[model samples]
Target: MGHPAEVEVLSKALSGIGVDEKSLVSILTQSHHEHKRTIKRGCSQFFVEDERHFERWNDDAIKTLKAEFKRFKALHFMK
Candidate 1:
């Protein structure tokens, strides 16, 4: 549950109908590298389904886009 509050905020930002880009940027940009790594690791615990599950999204294009962006941010910033 690494950084549960941060993880919850991130989960909220990525869940539901739309993304909270402001929240995402605020968290990712302000967090330390180690914190980002914790968040990245937490994502696996939270989103246990599968990364490719995002591609199966057909009901909402925005959701798919949001999910893909989430993946991108995780990969790009977690370094």
Candidate 2:
């Protein structure tokens, strides 16, 4: 299947209050392992740009946000 902008999609998924966990799941799980690696690396831009958005959130959201990414890595990156 044709892949759209991997970074862009990931950026959107990671944007807004808290992480878009569902969107992350839909995108990461559908992509190949190599593509997942690409997504993992490309996540920097999203964090840097959206850092302010996440900053207002409480520590719990911060922890949950990390957990969300870890979930993505576990499901998509781990064999």
Give the candidate number with the greatest TM-score: 1
- Superposition TM-score, candidate 1 onto the true structure: 0.55
* lDDT tens readout by residue for model 1, 1-79: 2478988898788777766777878988888888887997765533333466552323354457567687778876999
* Pairs of residues at least 3 apart in sequence or in different chains that clash in candidate 2: none
Estimate the TM-score of every prediction: 0.55, 0.46
Encode model 2's per-residue lDDT on 1-79: one tens digit a residue.
Answer: 3245767766776666546777677887788878776775666543333355642334554576798777767877766
Candidate 2: 10-residue stretch with minimal lDDT: 46-55
Q: Per-model C-alpha lDDT, please?
A: 0.70, 0.64
Q: Cα RMSD (Å) between model 2 and the true structure?
A: 9.3
Question: Which parts of model 1 are misplaced by more than 4 Å?
Answer: 45-63, 66-79
RMSD of 1: 9.4
Give the CA lDDT, 0 to 100, for residue 29 in model 2: 75
- The 10-residue segment with the lowest total lDDT in model 1: 54-63
Instruction: Give the winner by lDDT.
Output: 1
